[model samples]
Target chain A: MRGYAEDKDAYLKRLRRVEGQIRGLQRMIDEDEYCIDVLTQVGAVTKALQAVSLGLLEDHLEHCVAEALAEGGEVADEKLREANQAIARLVRS
Target chain B: MRGYAEDKDAYLKRLRRVEGQIRGLQRMIDEDEYCIDVLTQVGAVTKALQAVSLGLLEDHLEHCVAEALAEGGEVADEKLREANQAIARLVRS
Candidate 1:
């Protein structure tokens, strides 16, 4: 479970904005918008998504991973392994 | 800048364990550990890290992006652009 519940309305509002951005991008593509402008918008979206992912990742490590590790032994090892793979993915991306 | 200061020690501790897991994986590779086992561990790490990223991303959207949007005009558009690019990157990864 999530250790904390972030503001639902705020979360949804941000997501909604992102959704609009995506649709705009789609429209841009349909209309053949300038390549650079499209790319620039793409970069913005990437950063925003990263920001969101980073928050979740931190919370999970602090709560889920920590709790599992506190339990010790195989669980700890498992959580450690899980974390490492996650980092690898982030780096690869 | 970060809007919040997460627990430093706790964050470091989790990172340290992940670091150890990586080193262990390296050793496993050197020793020709079972391919299946290595892949399994790799998967675990991926999930752990994803959890962390998600937490951070949520916070960024809620705080940074939202604040910028509330400020209005070009700032809102810029934030929206940034966020869209971020989500794109996340999906690609």
Candidate 2:
């Protein structure tokens, strides 16, 4: 959903890189790599994943949220609530 | 930064609603709206803002991060470190 399938190639590429980074991290863990080095890799992975989440969220807002707003009713309010909860989760996390 | 200035209208619109939601939440607090009602609204606003963050993060990875990776050197490693730090912040938050 959320139009992600439409951009499968690009998404998959990014995800693959992320997956590689994850494996690298696993190796670091197994090898007892320096804590700072491992943590640094972790931070990169986090940002990368966050980037994907953000893309999906933006697309949802621009398309779905905008459409709901255009309809003009409880939809706007409802979408607003949805958006708020999402932000909260991001911030909370 | 982060290309947000390019889409001023759209970003502003989303931000405005988010701002309004924030104000509404403040009012709810002042008026002592039902705790659940206020919290629910808060959640909505949180999700909305997170959407914005996610969008920016995605762009960074696609453009900046990807470019960094392509350079194929210390840049890739450095960008990876940066990405990890960013993700850590997101997750920590």
Candidate 3:
């Protein structure tokens, strides 16, 4: 099972809400909303997406990475590398 | 007119693409995609949103804020504060 399997529903819910926010942003633009107002909304959506990333990262570390580390082999090394890379991507994003 | 008025269509196009990305994310979750892959896609979407924010900020600075600053008064101060606050929000996100 995937690391986020247990919380899949919650993740889906959050993603769907973000989808709505994106749609809202389009609406704001259509209405010629002020740039700062639009930027504020964009900030909110970015934070929500970051939160989802954090949750997924936590679950992956707790389950997938932990399991691989317990196995103690090349797979463990690969998993650790992948996790770190994802983290770097997260920080850079 | 809003600062982004000249590029409204471009902004809308970008936002629609982001909306599509959000849908793609929901699909990945439904299919139980790997955590790292999901995280990578989230980063892509986040970067896309950040690009939009940056575009709006540039337009605001070039047009709205610039206009207020040219006028040179309390309105200019208010615009500067608002722009700075928006920048802080972007950085924090």
TM-score of chain B of each: 0.82, 0.82, 0.97
| Residue B28 of model 2, lDDT score | 96
Worst 10 residues of 2 chain A by lDDT: A61-70
DockQ of each: 0.03, 0.07, 0.93
Comparing 1 and 2 on lDDT, the stronger one? 2
Tell me the lDDT of model 3 at B68. 98
| Second chain TM-score for model 1 | 0.82
TM-score of chain B of 2: 0.82
Q: Each candidate: fraction of true contacts kept?
A: 0.00, 0.10, 0.91
State TM-scores per candidate: 0.47, 0.48, 0.99
Please, what are the lDDT tens digits per residue for candidate 3 over residues B35-93? 99999999999999999999999999999999999998999999999999999888877
Top-lDDT candidate index: 3
lDDT of each: 0.66, 0.70, 0.96
* A4-93: candidate 2 lDDT, tens digit per residue: 656668888999999999999999999999999999999999989888876665555545554555465687558646764664476566
After superposing all C-alphas onto the true structure, candidate 1 shows an RMSD in angstroms of 14.6
- Sort candidate 2 into its docking category: incorrect
Tens-digit per-residue lDDT, A1-93, candidate 1: 673355446556777888999999999999999999999999888777766666555555545655664465787567656754664466457
